[model samples]
Target: MHGEPAVLSVTRYHPENPIKMFLLQPLYAPLLFPNTTSDARDHCANERTFLSWLRLAIYMAIVAVAILVNFHLKNQPTPLERRLSHPMGIIFWVLSLACLVTGLAIYMRTVTKYAKRRALVQTGMKTQAVFLVVSAAIIAACALFLAAEVQASRQGHAGAFDVTFVL
Candidate 1:
């Protein structure tokens, strides 16, 4: 036991709160045992990167919500408008979920690498950029779908109700 690090046995002290202990153990481990300044900075940077990804996920989710709300509130005046709205809504929702899952996956990967004390600079950038590119592509697809929906809606409205100026 001379060279071995001491481990805190949470169950020994809080026998009734096993779930709390399990959930919080990892969170408090760093505070309990301080690491070198470089390690601390690395962890902080990792957290910042995770937050950035989380922010992007949130933004995408917001866009999905906006699309959902728009479809819900707006009355579809024509059959074409009604038909296009449903698929566009689905695409936006799926894109949002994909972004969220990808963001979480990247965060988990970075955390695992950091825990393993692996060099994260090169690997992290490449993986993150790939995810970003995929997310961007999905977003672009959603945008195109949205544009098509808008165009169809406008055409439907024009054909159904637009007044023509004839001399």
Candidate 2:
């Protein structure tokens, strides 16, 4: 509307898995570029950061699912343990679910071929930065959940072992 418009170019898609890539974009896009830019400086944000977040999220989620899932669960330990069920195990499962869902959501949001910069210092930087923070935080949460679950399981196993040993 004013002077000549500036050029805005975005790289085309070449994800590891074109389909799942979109499912993981929200977690990765902002992480890669906390600030939207066509910048060519080392200080500037890059795509690697975004992918790393996704990597961590995926890793944490898989670990969580692996640890929490696939027990026959026939009158089984009530998720956590006998007493009240292990809170950490339940929490870990919930966190893992959240990570998977959130990652899918973000990835879906960014599937399109190009995302233009509407205006300089507009929503992209602010929005993407927020997304990045959220992605990182989610990963951390997943890790915490896993940690709690592991600790609880160890305690449960130890308690059980001690009781048997007493006999």
* lDDT (CA) per prediction: 0.54, 0.43
Best candidate according to TM-score: 1
Candidate 2's TM-score: 0.31
Tell me the tens digit of each residue's lDDT in model 2 across 1-167. Answer: 67744332234433444354444544444323224554334222223434544665566566445445533333233333333223433545455455455544443344322232222322245446545655665576456545545655567787443221100
Clashing pairs in 1: none
Candidate 2 Cα misplacement greater than 4 A, ranges? 1-46, 69-90, 101-114, 119-167
Q: How many residue pairs clash in each candidate?
A: 0, 9
C-alpha RMSD between model 2 and the true structure? 12.4
Alpha-carbon TM-score of each model against the true structure: 0.53, 0.31
Best by lDDT: 1
- Which digits, one per residue and each the tens of the lDDT, describe model 1 over residues 38-135? 86677677667767767766766666665555443344433543555556557656656666665556555554544444536544565566567656
